[model samples]
Target: QQPVQSPQAVILREGEDAVINCSSSKALYSVHWYRQKHGEAPVFLMILLKGGEQKGHEKISASFNEKKQQSSLYLTASQLSYSGTYFCGTEMAGSARQLTFGSGTQLTVLP
Candidate 1:
């Protein structure tokens, strides 16, 4: 099943912080985060495994709670360049290369 992301959209000011959450009904093997800008392809951010790992990329970080089948993305000191549609991709156990993506969270960082 496709993962669900909360807050379909978010507006944040520069240097602010925001959190985006993703949850799945089924067990997951790994979770991937990506950000896509207008007219651009999604860029890989980071990935967290089932062991409940947390990953960080620049000012952004994410945590995966395997037991709860949920994940959260944290954006610290939000920047205008961070404005984009963020997506959470999930892979089921024993499933390779087949990633199911969440609806998406639109983040707008304003000055």
Candidate 2:
């Protein structure tokens, strides 16, 4: 099953930081995080594997909770460029590479 993200929408000012969490009930093969601006396809951020691996792009960092089957994406020092929707997709164990996705968390950055 896809993980659920908290705080469906977060209102933030410039320089603020927020956390988006994705959690699943089933065992996960990997967790992938993506960000999408309105009306566009999601942009991949990072992937976390079972071996305690982490990846990032720009200022975004994500972590995988192997024991809990969860992942969290951290957005630091918010920017106007950071405004968008964030989604976490989970790859099921013994399943194909394609991920089952969570309903996205909408993020808004305010000046």
Candidate 3:
């Protein structure tokens, strides 16, 4: 099943911080984060695997909890360039290994 993200939309000012969450009903094998700007394809952000290490880029970071089957994206000191729609793609065990993305989280960063 596709994971569900909370706070469908987020409006932030420059230098602000925001967190987006994703949860699944089944056990997760991996969680992938991506961001897509208008008129562009989604760009890979990072991926978290069960019992694997977490990763971060710039001021963005993410964590995945295998026990809870949940993941969270943390954007710190947000910038105007960070404005985009974020998606979380999840992989579940015993599945086809296909990734199913959450609806999306619309994030707008204002100056």
Candidate 4:
């Protein structure tokens, strides 16, 4: 099943912070985060495995909760370049390389 993302849209100022959540009703093997800008393909951000490891790059980070079958993406000290649509893709157990993506969460960072 496709995961559900909360706060469909977010408007933030530079240096602010925001969180985007994704949850699935069924069990998930992994969760992937992607960002897509207008007229560009989605770019992979990071992935969290069932072990519930928290992964981060720069000011962006994500955490996975295996028990809750949920994941959250955190944007810290947001920058104007952070504006984009964020998508969470879920992979089910036994499903290799296949992912079910959520509708997406639009994030806008203003100066």
Winner on TM-score between 1 and 3 is 1
Residue-wise C-alpha lDDT for candidate 3, range 1-111, written one tens digit per residue: 778998799999999999999999988889999999999999999999998457799999999888888899999999999999999999988778899999999999999
- Models 1 onward score TM values of 0.97, 0.93, 0.95, 0.98
Taking the tens digit of each residue's C-alpha lDDT, what string does model 4 give over 1-111?
Answer: 789998899999999999999999989999999999999999999999999999999999999999999999999999999999999999998887799999999999999
The runs of at least 3 residues in candidate 1 whose Cα sits more than 4 Å from the true structure, single-residue gaps closed, are none
**Candidate 3 wrongly placed segments (more than 4 Å):** none
Better of 1 and 2 by TM-score: 1
Number of the top-ranking candidate, with TM-score as the measure: 4
What's the lDDT for candidate 4?
0.96
Specify the highest-lDDT model's number.
4
Model 3 alpha-carbon miss at residue 46, Å: 0.1
Specify the poorest-scoring 10-residue window by lDDT in model 4. Answer: 90-99
Number of backbone collisions per candidate, in order? 0, 0, 0, 0
Q: Tell me how far the alpha carbon of residue 55 in candidate 2 is from the true structure, in angstroms, after superposition.
A: 3.0
TM-score pick, better of 2 and 3 = 3
